[model samples]
Target: MSNAAVLWRRVVAEAVGTGLLVTVVVGSGIAASSLSPGDVGLQLLENSFATALGLGVLILMLGPVSGAHFNPVVSAVDWWLGRRTGAGLTSRELTAYVPAQIVGAIAGAVLANLMYAKAAVSWSTTDRSTGHLWLGEIVATAGLIVLIFALGWSGRAAVAPAAVGAYIGAAYWFTSSTSFANPAVSIGRAFSDTFAGIAPGSLVGFVVAQLFGAVVGVGLLAILYPDAGRAADEIVTPHTDTTTTGATT
Candidate 1:
């Protein structure tokens, strides 16, 4: 296959993978709220479990096609870590992947809303803006990056699907923000005024915190695993397609 075709396939994988991820998040949240009505704790448990299972399955399904990033921060971190050694995504792939992920995420949220008979693009009223919440986002995102890169560096990529899913599920309880660690997910959640949504007004802070968290995660990786960059291409999981050459991730 041509390089262009391969890139196109990867972009589609990222989009579809991310979209489904958001669907799992928003849809499960809606269902959880409906099922557990007044029991906030039970609702969260349902949402988290469903998200964890869905995410792991999605990663397993799409990892070979696109690394299953599903998050812009993950893609960007891949680019940054591999820029010097050319182990991860190229600039072109990064540009293509990020937008596709974002658009896919938004579409996923809308799909979730429609599925539940809610208005599409309801614009979340759940405002999550606050210093502590931003801190939670930073901590959640940083930990995610560290966990993902650590697995890659340690040649444990095979378990990334389970490990990542478990981490996010746990973070849902541990973090104050319920770990909306992905900027694309954060944006996508804004389109739904449901249990999983974040108000549009709070997006900037969450996104900024996530970006900052990525930077922190990278720094920590540098210190803890100085050779982490060597495994950049294998992040999330290794891909079989070599059509993109050195920019597989």
Candidate 2:
């Protein structure tokens, strides 16, 4: 496809994938809370599992077209990892993507909140004490990034979507933060005062922890899969030169 066509496709994929992710996440959160009142842990678990399934499906559906970067953190990390080594979205395009995700998330939260009366939607308060919550965020986000990079970027794993789904589902049980690995998703859920809300003040800790986890994941991947990143130039440079030679000849 032409560059313009590819760019448009990528944008559409991102928008649709992100929109679906947020909607399902918030919707599931609300559903869990309504079904099981006062059982915050179970509610969060349900939300996490649903999110994982939703994300996996969306990624599988959109990975071929746009890489399915439904979160800004993933997009930024992919760029930093040099995965966008060749003709990909520009800074301007990336800048636009985050806002679209945030907007979509907010819309999702609003719709979910409306589904279940706003008054019934209570903010999250399941032992997110300052210290414990921060620690949980760190562990949760780290695992998520590791899974994404390992299965999606490394190209060694078969059925990346299934791998990601399992990782998320496991992370929810293992990590204290219940596996809220995406900063955008975390912040977006905050808008809805439902089972997913992080108590506005809690957002800072979650975002910070998530960013730290991303950096850690990148570092670990660098060490564990050093050659994974080397493919970009090796493939692109040779292909470009070959094309040029063909044109000249």
The candidate that achieves the highest lDDT relative to the unseen native structure? 1
C-alpha lDDT (0 to 100) for residue 83 of candidate 2: 49
lDDT of 2: 0.65
- 21-124 per-residue lDDT for model 1 (tens digits): 99999999999999999999999999999999999999999999888899999999999998888699999999999999999999999999999999988999
TM-score of 1: 0.97
For all candidates, the clash counts are 0, 0
- For model 2, residues 82-158, the per-residue Cα lDDT tens digits are 54454333566577667776666666666677766664234555334487767777777666666666654455433
Backbone clash pairs for candidate 1 read none
Q: Tell me the spans in candidate 1 whose CA falls farther than 4 Å from its real position.
A: 242-249
Model 2 lowest lDDT segment of ten: 234-243
State each model's C-alpha RMSD to the native. 1.9, 5.9
How do the predictions measure up, each by TM-score? 0.97, 0.79
lDDT of each: 0.93, 0.65
Name the 10 consecutive residues with the lowest summed lDDT in model 1.
Answer: 240-249
The list of candidate 2 runs beyond 4 A from truth reads 83-90, 117-129, 230-249
